[model samples]
Target: MMASSDPAVIQTRALSKRYRTVAALTDCTITVPEGRISALIGPNGAGKTTLLRLLAGLARPTGGDIAVLGTAPRPDPAFLAGIGFLAQEIPLYRRMSAADHIRIGAHLNARWDGTSVRQRLEGLGIPLGQAVGTLSGGQRAQLALALTLAKRPRLLLLDEPVAALDPLARRQFLAHLAEAAAGGGLTVLLSSHLLSDLERICDHLVLLAGSRVQLCGDVDALLAEHQILVGPRKDTTAIERDHTLVHAVRTPRQTTLLIRRNGPVIDPAFETADVSLEELVLGYMGQHADGPSPAHLSAIGGDQ
Candidate 1:
């Protein structure tokens, strides 16, 4: 892999994949800026994992292109060294201690930092002598993360790293990851069904649906461009036509609308309500949630 000075750590163009009659991804394009956490979200089978695997070099795209750190996901040792991935399913050695698995990371990774790993593990208070198979689900997840972080990869590809963690653990893990992104210039692409979990940490959000990107942008800026208003049901028709209705609820005499519009404070018919990041993401995925439920809510090891 050839290194460049560009800050764009991950970039893709028209990326797609298909399996027989199923189209898993179609014309997917996204850019993850350097030094920030980017959340890749979508409804079940919206191609979140498919796109992630393409970037991680674990699976080949059926069509289209992908580049990590300005080079194709080829078998370049240098390129591989620049990235560390924690799969949705735990990938640690079942018989090994947390410490042993970390040793593997040190042996295999080009940029592995022993001191960093020790410090992080010590900070987390993860017992190193126990076998990974014996630990609880959340502990195992932290062990997996420890192995990845010890490598000190420039680009971190995590597929729901915190899904199995408890609320406190989840918060702690993401807080550290966010700090790493802020201080180490680490670029992360994480996919999860829990939008609220990422709300406070991630800088950018990407929503995928129907095998394509529905929206992608800075979280704060994106919300600013969209607003929610609630008022008499009589205003529904006008609100739907003039602004994008992300989601809406109707009561006997009042209707609530989450619209993508900005400008002026001059709406006498409806009252505006600020939407949280969770509401914003749920708004986009709500359209597809009615079809077959969501494949996203299923945990990583369910029925495995």
Candidate 2:
């Protein structure tokens, strides 16, 4: 459960992971507050999977430190039980029936809620006699989620859990996820490239690019601090003096500027529009593409 002190549920300082010659993650650091749904996003080959694996204690870091639920990532059974992970593949025994899976879950988890799991599967119209191999992709994903939630974990880690589901299925999955979190103090860290679903469910955001954390903070606060200015194509000398320009694109007639506003935008020539979560994420990613790696940013790990 979340404490009144508001301690960060997950924290990493200079955390790094390497596989032979490849550095999957480099000097990464971020903080996730308890009970918030945080979206971890990045392009392909951006180390998103590697970071999730590290958090799950499936792999050890080559350097730095990471603490989840106030302890370092480890293979301890008790620590593992406190975390419920649903991998992207949605691994399940193809030969087993849905009832068999439920039985297995109850046998493995100390806090498994059999009644809740049974009710969830039944409500979704997943037959207890149906073989896992015969279930649809969406049904399989739902089943995986049901099993995880039944464990009543404090922290839930989902890696692209909805990437394979259809729009309707995605909606249903997120709705169920929201209810689960609201029912208890569940902290979630979900990685996905689907920004649409993320914006609908996540209250916090973490952007990773070039094997580093590009941005991390409360979603609303981050949005409030960023704005996209559209105006005539001209020198941005005046605007640059007041705001941090994240990215800028200019055409013959118009200019679009993605800036982090430090104060009010008093300029009348420029029409400012609220930046959506997608735009904000893309802007940061664009900046990453144009600028140096996050290693150059001295305060990369600090509060945004």
Candidate 3:
């Protein structure tokens, strides 16, 4: 978890977006500290894309407030220069070659580093002169990433960047992404459904489900705060009274629960165990699959 003293690179308070008949996001409040690789995970249509669009200044929020790098996101050159956004489709000119894209990037971006980007593509064995349309899906994804990184943006936003790639290609893309993030001075908010992949490189977590943030915090701290309790099928009144229940399952003779521990579980009937990242995420998702209960909404973790 980031210390309270650390400066926030991204902050949102009661952020929301609506499209007439549909609400894309609602009351999302989270703070991402500078230089942290944060994972934004949620099921499809959970407003992950809408949130990224809002952060990138591509779309305006219907309500609430947002701040990126100490100011609201805008379309101005200075603000755009400090942020890079790569949508799921990996927008690029398919008719143009990789070199051509680099040339265009240099002209459009004030802080472009075409030399480094070209070298990166060359090192990957990607043909710089070939049209991007002829390249593999993996190659195009890499080229888009390289161009985005070359801008030297303070914040990077990626929306399901590797969803269409093969396993090996996904691994390769993440390796390159990990390398870039290791250089410091970069704050990344990556949206992906691959929990295992996100766990490998992300320290901070923002879980959006049912069009709202269910959990947002440091992965380690969140893990430590939650526990799985397995016990005989019995009345849960006492357990519920002592802890914040995130999810529960009951069989004929056993009852298992995922709970945010409030204090010591002094009851001898229940056995406690640590929860994994996947378990924690699924538990919360299952709990809020229909929509968050009033109690669950009030107990959301992390800032706001």
Candidate 4:
């Protein structure tokens, strides 16, 4: 478990990114502490990729600031050596064999650990002599991950790395990731739409909707701060005055409200229940479908 006092490995303030007429991200701010695997999730066109690109220093932000490893990202050798980024496409030479790629990595990366990475691939029964193009999708993904891990970066940023893998492959990929993270000294920011998979390996969360941050916090802290309230259908003016209403659904006789507690719900009218991570994420995403108000867009915990 990561403690609250852990130093931040990633921070952004009022970050904005625009591509011609479209705004990819707007006034986004977030913080990720060291030694955490954070899930970055949002709907399509919500700027998840843009954020990852900016953090990796592949693209510059149009406005605001971003810091990774306590300094602004740059293309210098030291900065590049400290972080490993695997884009969604999983860039690799299709014509090259796994052994050929390993040799290339050894020459290109100063900290390359080809021996360990090759051993890992061999243990998985991934043939070293086979051309990468002929390998299965899972094999290619694993190969890419192994190469990235070979660099031994302190921070790893992945953009939908496993979206194309089947269920068993995804499970295997996540298991490998979990094993790597268990060694400590590594921080990962993974962008994926699979909420259940994220829940299994991530302890931190950064949720984006409407091209802005909707929620950002430690998983346990966020869950502890939110709850579901069920009661008879009626005007919620009084309730609204006290809590941050994340989502509300009303039926003929009853109303269910998911809320971020401003304080304890002492009102006898509502019965409280625990909120699951999937339910919490869905509520925030649904609430922001029509554009979230300023009041609802605040970061839940950590630096804003």
Candidate 5:
């Protein structure tokens, strides 16, 4: 059994899931530390949904182990109360009013905050008397989030929560999410393809590509460890020996490399530039592009 006091709110060891003959997630291992927003990113069909569903206790893994909030994901009411999940569809009863949904949520959650939920809807100008089906996309999104927040969960799992919202609506929703996370004792794991938005709100990142965990770590720490070096075009044999190269490009006049450096650089010919979150994610995604899959590195080693 994993320790209750383990800093990671979620942990998986060699976790995998298969849909018939197709493997959705393979040999996956990762950790999502507590009290911070962690973004799960990957390209289409990269198993982001499968991983999130497993964590949400909606699906069972075919192999390996997973623990949510220190216990195995379970369907028991006591266990379910600790987690709140919002899927990409954001399902709500079409004929129900905002008040009706609030009442239903109060009955369903042991720690439901009805008053707070009502205030959030009202503050957002979501009418209590209007049927949900009549609400705008942005309004419905707000309503879905409010309901989830009212559950007062220990960990919130969001699957592309803002994928359909407009720019202004997306900002508003994230602002509310940030405020809720700031209020202590709540941890969030959200998956999205929007790298720019993730950079704005997420403190930690887990990047999956080809159904594998390519990178996972604190956003700041990972960025600091990986650097982009620009220098004159030369043989990369020596640098490749020390640094784990992710991606490299060269022209007749210059060369630039995205590398995971374990030590201080003493090379006089190269100038190191900071790597952005998008660059880091893309570098890992491109790891398998040019040749056979690169052997996995222990840059930010997984829980396994």
Candidate 6:
């Protein structure tokens, strides 16, 4: 891609971190378009957190390469300068107050905007005089966020940033991400098991399940491609074999199906409705299930 189209962040072919036998990520090729908010979501061990770590350059990729702002990681000044990372459990000096932490943030980030830092936290109603160790989980997350935004990053990689918060607090934190991206063209890639929270903030999705990418694309496009059809139960054969079955449920009276079809459904017995992003994602993840199902979600990783 030309520099104009070149994203500030990219992973040409990033594969990394196998724990003796299991591969965390295998030949993961992807990119983050400049200034867009992308969500990397997956189940507990789906390698979502692992990918976030690699992107932040906290751990070396076991096999392939990754680039941030056109540079490599770990003390790569330009890359480090342009990225602001809020790890899963952001570390803080136990004794430091919110105000003191911002001071430390100012020290590391070359472009630290002190006034902006204070204003952001104050705007959020986070008391600067209180010590980091004294803050609640949600408050601490906000504090970490305050430190990160204070850096004026070109890219922000957040991992379950609001996982510890209540519903209301979650809203407040996500709003911060939205404002940051809109006002300054900040590219953000966040990972969360909280699909609802992510759904509200992300424009793009990267769904990971079973340690590999299942789907990747724009949120609206995926929802448009797959569909849910509700109607009478058939012998599994008569329901319409035209579409690749993504998910199927059989009740005594009727059946609901999720499918990926090349064209329109011609089945007269079925009533088709557009699948929500959540349903589209669940269909992909449930493709191989023998009987039961766990939770499912969507990103934009593309056909499992």
Residue by residue across 21-47, what tens digits does model 2's lDDT show?
998998888888998899999887788
> Per-residue CA lDDT of candidate 6, range 205-228, in tens?
787767777666667766776788
Q: Cα lDDT of all candidates, in order?
A: 0.75, 0.85, 0.90, 0.88, 0.85, 0.75
Best by lDDT: 3
Candidate 1 residues lying further than 4 Å off, grouped into runs, are 1-6, 235-241, 262-267, 290-304
Q: After superposition, how far is residue 171 of candidate 5 from its true place, in Å?
A: 0.3
Q: What global local distance difference test value does model 5 have?
A: 0.85
| Native-to-model Cα distance after best TM-score fit, residue 13 in candidate 2, in Å | 1.4
Candidate 3, residues 247-291, lDDT tens digits: the string is: 888999999999989888877999999999999999988887846
For each candidate, what TM-score against the reference?
0.84, 0.91, 0.95, 0.95, 0.93, 0.86
TM-score of candidate 5 on Cα atoms, chains taken together: 0.93
Mind sharing the TM-score for model 4?
Answer: 0.95
Models, CA RMSD each: 6.7, 3.1, 1.9, 2.5, 2.9, 4.2
Tens digits of per-residue lDDT for model 4, 175-286: 9888988999999999987677678999999998768888888999999989999999888878876887888889999999989888889878899999999999999888
Consecutive 10-residue window with the lowest summed lDDT within model 4: 295-304
Model 4: pairs clashing at backbone N, Cα or C within 3 Å:
none
* Pick by TM-score: 5 or 6, better one: 5
Ranked by TM-score from best down, the candidates are 3, 4, 5, 2, 6, 1
Superior candidate under lDDT, 3 versus 6: 3
Off by over 4 Å in 6: 1-8, 12-14, 235-242, 288-304
